[model samples]
Target chain A: MSAGDDVAVVGVGIHVFGRHDGVTGLEMGAIAARRALADAGITWQDVDFAAGGSDAAGNADTSVSILGLTGVPFINVKNGCATGGSALTTAHAMLVSGAADLALVVGFDKHPRGAFNPLPEDWGIGSWYGETGLMLTTQFFALKIRRYMEEHGITESTLAKVAAKAFANGARNENAWRRTPLSEQEILSSRMVNHPLTQYMFCSPGEGAVALVLARSRRIRELARVPVYLRSVAFRTRRFGSFEVFSPSIPIESAPSATTEAAAAAFEEAGIGPGDVDVAQIQDTESGAEVMHLAETGLCEHGEQESLIQSGGTELHGRLPINTDGGCLACGEPIGASGLRQVHEVVLQMRGDAGERQVAKHCRVGFTQVYGAPGVSACTVLTV
Target chain B: MTKTRQFRLIDPELIGGTEQVPRLIGSVCAGCGTVTFPRQRSCPRCTSEDVQPRELAIRGELWSWTIQCFAPKAPPYLPGGVEEFEPYGVGYVELPGEVRVEARLTESDPERLRIGMSMELTLIPVPGASDTLTFAFRPVEEDE
Candidate 1:
């Protein structure tokens, strides 16, 4: 009667994650949305409600324009990197409230080149802070990962291993950007973008889109051959003391990161624990993030990453494979679209449709999460 | 002695953002005792308007650090020009009992720096940018 009652993801689609030199963000989003509708075996006019968020650079409400001007309620929710998750959550509410039988969730972005240099003033952080040149998103990932490595016994090798695995998994994904299989040593020796995090160890900002078509259980049973149920979905903004993006300072004693909090909430909502998940796709803006998030999601203990990573426990054949489709590590993040991309991978895995890179174990349940600035995170649990 | 005027790129608050012997300006909430760098109009914690400007400790230990190898974009960050730009070290220095400040690290050699080592603030003059002054933290030598 709660989260997973009758809402099901009948279809999902994603644009290849890479540079779309001449294409606009809206164009890329439209392509993915159309693909999703086609997969859902439904026309655009069949959608009763649409939810999504787009980057300011490309009009936020481009979902309607891209999906064709359906007079349905097209609500665009913007919550940083959690935008896609927010879209799914909003659409699910419509089904639960008996407001809509079918819904569409779309997310897309075309990031500016180079590292993200957010105007400090825009986030109320002031220009002097930006002038310090310390607010670069690269540095944020580097600093946090550096601190995490020190606190936890995570070795530089462990970081390299995560990237190596991600790139290897990404190599099997036709939609991934950096599909070249990277060895651990090569990742370790890549150009140092920031200490502890080499260039290969980080996900670059890129253009892409992801969309999901959802329907009530009744409609899904009739239309979809195998409906992937939305087990749980949750989004959380950063609470006080979190060392999130654009923060001037964090409290000495603080709550866990946004991803950690959201993961806990998603698990609780679904009444499922980490052990129940057969596959997972977590945030990996940097290799360290994947490591930290794996532990934060209660998938493993804080200091267990060193041994777990060495045992190849997170590989595709492992008991609980993580980042099966390379995750953000191989497919550079497109912010709004990244969360749904995680969902798409989980859906494909659940449906036993993933080729080559499919997990060795049957994926009955899966998890996906995304985290971003000024401080926000969204997580969802899915199952067949 | 040559005379030169010093300015904080935008705010005057950063110049004295810390208190103690070095004195960095900060804001304190009368209701909740919350202290923040670059003085704000009110307390973020208690939503109290009784927030007043105060000074924060200038000394702290190194919490974490990173090196910015790429040149920041032109507008907000005046890192001279790309050719003139050199990679610099930055870190979050934790002023015990106060706030952890994000500032440029004076030390670039990772070998010489330790996470818990004591750090002291030192103002760095930015060239090309007229009369601009920025801050950095250097590892405090035992002999000093």
Candidate 2:
């Protein structure tokens, strides 16, 4: 492959994540796609390949009825929280293979209030497991973080700090759902959803959409003035003995989480070290997720979060800003859209277009990670 | 005197011992010796078909824990409504030399729960349905 065989994100768009009263998920996706196309200074007919997905929303390809059916090869992806990542991976491969000059990948989702009520049969668990009140993603996160805290000397204050920082950033992001910055005390004292995690600390399942227009390296300069190079994209699933969501039991032996593996692989492929990342967007399903992922993604040491977070190292102006768009914590997690949202935020930050919430550092390299149910993770590295 | 009728477990395949000393039903792989709860037909580690049903240990130490303060949505969660729900303890108890099992704990107060504390397998009424029983792990008393 030539040096110009790589792919880059030329444009991006988003349908403000949170409650959308009358709009369907498909309509949001079509809207985002059109916005991304406009940002790229191109029309839908110019796209040669497309891919997208949503968890509870309709098939991604069905958005064509709204976006105008140009007969694009729109592949549908459904990898839980990694839905957007999987779509990007597919498009990246297609572009690198010389099959497509331009690609449009979108992800959108609309979930009902409260936690996701997934079926036991759908996840290979017996009904008894769910009936016993052990089927909650919140409980799993709480349990994992509880153990991690005990082992790593992480405090409840640190957990609250993560959520507070998310809101602080969200307040600056016009499209974010929870725009009001909350104090760490407020976050800590909020109604406890799961022990050690309060209402303010966990992100609610909500609705939104995001789209990205990618192009072959050679076409990036022509399509956009400041294209964010898609350095690498990696996805991985759980290995045996790893703790994950929806488990009745875990093996005695332990292994690295999917996020750990995917992050390592993405960094390796991008030839970028964790220390070099000026900005990042890791999954923050809850405060604990962000804390553990900070270490798992090799961004920091396992126990360093206590000091890193407490000292404001994760703030937008800090040494390494994380989730500058407020992440799932403030924007709310629209499963399919959440992953793509991370990438979109990185692209905006790299292009100096993140507005009020942009990183203070000169961000040359940015990283994004999305982890989800059934132990799946997707990581990406982007450069200006 | 009238005798009390015995309550049935949530699922027969999950537990397999007398009421006084109930044990979780698990499958041990003949190929890799990996033990899985609720008895799988194949080994998760080696994908071996030579898996056999085995009654897991009844005692273990709490590995990790949390309290579920909100009631889960119904359909998948066959339990009480939001108004009738009470916060409950949830945790993973690691059986010695065996797998760590996730279960509801009898204790909901965080002050009373700690990792590495001794826990014993027991049965509790499935919330909202006292007629049906489900497995749980309760802190072991000092005298017992």
Candidate 3:
């Protein structure tokens, strides 16, 4: 068995991103699953195991007949917004362990709109802190970036560029939730939800679903479709002294984020550096997020964002195109599906199937990451 | 005079006792000397069981902050209602030789806040909150 021959994301599907009225999250999940099955040139019966992730209730649990009553081992996984990435990690492990020849990973959510107000104890945070109304997800992100800006000299314009790029790319994506392109001024002028985090800069909570079908080398090689192999899947939770969502207080000293830790492990496992990534899809829960994440993912050094973004180096035609499918900025986050949607975009980009927003460079590899509330992160590397 | 009640919204240990200096109470590890606010049971850094509660610095530098323009959801969160909603500043104050604590700010005006500026502990009544004491930070008043 070759080192990279364990399993591949042979097929992928999505139910767009946005409010899907009159449809249950289960229905959206099933629809996306069928699309993924069709894309894989297989059927529900072929799935030997199922892994599901979602933050809301009802849908993901009794997901058996939604795809067909296969009586498979349906393992439900949840890692906040990293739900999809977590599911992929589980499905990949099952395939690598030789536990299943075919595994289906799906993430779908229809959560209540607006910012999340997760309980403290729910994520192991202090109850005294949780009751104080400090649980808004956006403020956590803003606070981290605010400190980063102080140390790194990142200006408000640098943050605006990230949002502008998302809408520009999102305008070309047929499945994007907010296809209306936003100018930097509009994004800057949008109502300030939090200082430096204007309304347009923050992604909304919306509904969507995404799914992936994975298989072994022999099973996937025979298919006519060009295989988008799963190079590595890494997951990491918050470590000590890390400033994260719902954390009321941190130690006197700060530590590297979970994303940084997960990215390091992913790079080691994939046998690739950030430079090897031809395309990427990092979590952009807010405009400043993409900037900080670019540094956290090791794609760039601290304080390099001002020049990197100002130079249009992160644009679709720039040195390193990121979030080509609009990301959460344009798609609005549907927790469970957000991570998988990122992966699906990478799959499309790697396969040379991304129509309007395709990166012109010779794309050999792609990376996607998801960071979520209460300090958790998951990353995946893909190559064909 | 109309009778009124007051209380601390957070833990009592967080407040300064007798001195009225508003020293945040935390825990220090005997093994690695790690300091944590809200007082962790065990040392998160060294996993030391010999951790003890220690009062943190009352004065700090504002590392970062955000002006929350909207009120959060109700039921256990909104000490106040929609009509009472007012924009507020939320920030992390990095204390000398201690941990960074997230807290509400005495001032919400963005113009008055600057990173690295000195801040001192104060108290605020959460809108719609009944008999609760929550702490906040203000630009240290000049020369007392």
TM-score per candidate, chains pooled: 0.95, 0.98, 0.96
lDDT of 3 by residue, A1-384 (tens): 375356888888889888888998888888889899899999889889889878884547476776678788889987888888888888888888888888889999897877776766776665555446676787888888888898999999988889999999999998899999988899899899888889988998889989899997678886667889888999999899777887778776778999999998898998989888889999999988899899899999999999999999988888889999999999988899999999999999999999999998878989998998778899888898
* Rank ordering of all candidates by TM-score, starting from the highest: 2, 3, 1
Name the TM-score of candidate 3. 0.96
Superposition TM-score, candidate 2 onto the true structure: 0.98
Tens-place lDDT per residue, model 2, A1-384, is 367887899989999989999999999999999999999899999999999999999999998898888989999999999999999999999999999999999999999998998888899888877777777899999999999999999999999999999999999998899999999999999999999999999999999999999999678867645888899999999999888998889998999999999999999999999999999999999999999999999999999999999889999999989999999999999999999999999999999999988788899999999999999999999998
Q: Which whole-number lDDT from 0 to 100 does residue A127 have in model 1?
A: 75
Candidate 1: segments with Cα more than 4 A from true spot: A2-4, B1-10, B17-22, B79-83, B127-130
* Candidate 1 lDDT over residue span B45-74, tens digit each: 668999888877777899988888778885
Candidate 2's C-alpha runs over 4 A off are B1-4, B79-83
The number of the candidate with the highest lDDT is 2
User: For each of the candidates, what fraction of the native contacts does it recover?
Assistant: 0.61, 0.92, 0.69
Candidate 1 vs candidate 3: the DockQ winner is: 3
Clashes of each: 9, 0, 4
Report the error of model 2 at residue A206, Å. 0.9
Looking at model 1 chain A, report the run of 10 residues with the lowest lDDT sum: A54-63
Global fold similarity of model 1 (TM-score): 0.95
lDDT of 1 by residue, A236-346 (tens): 888767788776676676778788899999999888898788999998999988998898888888989888888899999987788989989899888888999999999
RMSD for each of the candidates: 2.4, 1.9, 2.4
